[model samples]
Target: MTDIFGVVADATRRELLQVLLERYLAPESATGDISVGELVEKLGLSQPTVSKHLKVLRDSGLVAVREVGQHRYYRLEPGPLDVVEEWLVPFLSVDSLGGGLEQGEASGAFAAWSGVQMPASLRRAGESLQHPSDAGAAVGRAMADATHGTRHRFEEASEAVERKVFDPIRKKLKKD
Candidate 1:
């Protein structure tokens, strides 16, 4: 079935989603639309590639587009994906793991899972996981310097995340 899951499964589409999400969350946007040129620049993808992904997003109803003179501006709708989220949220996090298991006894999740009647089994597992020495070793060796990406690539990535990821998430949190 061609659902939200299918639409987002492509890496290119996910990158486009990230771009749109950032633009939508920008403080300056009264309307959530972002232009194709902006997406092309941000994703470092060719214009044709961007347009193709945008078509998929539009077909899935995950994005809506508006025409402005010669330009087509696209924005995320986000509502249709709720069904996928509902189905997937159970795997995201189990509710306090089952029930009455207190904060510490379970150590991690699955502690509250009601099916595990004997907390003793859970306790034993937690005990084994306990590390005696969390001592930070002083290294005489210099750090192995490595680059995550080229300087331009890193800058572009950082800017996208700052604009498209963090800003939107912050705005949503502030609402709550």
Candidate 2:
């Protein structure tokens, strides 16, 4: 197995990963796959240079390639990132921070904001937000949390309305 750290160590490779991530997050990108020519145009790099970095990424299982006729498309393979995430989780733990934030407080505060259970990795990341020494930072985080909560609630309501109202009406209309 190639060292995942080594595979991601290059600046160009990281840029490539960021590009792939952007495509994955884009609403218009149905497949989240990008062609070599698109990547070359986006990054302003030569095709051979992009291909070289992509080969390294492919070997390390960080990206997957699909061949369509003669052209190839690449998309990010996020599974291999578990190795990095697992390694980093310990460092994000409250214990690792010398008890800066209590686990219960962190979990409770985050749960109240999110209104749902989060994975341990995300909880640990949230724990890092609750430092006792920074009042201003705490206020900032409170505002951000409130904003996120509002957005979450809005999305839930929107989805419910779509399912219970719009979807049924659309179905009825389609039947006629």
Residue 40, model 1: lDDT of: 89
TM-score for every candidate vs. truth? Answer: 0.56, 0.55
lDDT top scorer: 2
* Model 1 steric clash pairs: 22-164, 98-112, 98-113
Instruction: Flag regions of model 2 displaced more than 4 Å.
Output: 94-176
Model 2, span 1-176: residue lDDT tens = 79999988899999999889768765779989999999999899999999999999999999999999999999999899889865543333323222344344433344457674544544555677656666467546644654555456657986897689767976896899
Best by TM-score: 1
Residue 132, model 2, lDDT: 65
C-alpha lDDT values of all predictions: 0.67, 0.75
> Candidate 1's residue-wise lDDT over 53-114, tens digit each?
99989998989999989999999888877777555433333222233344444312233453
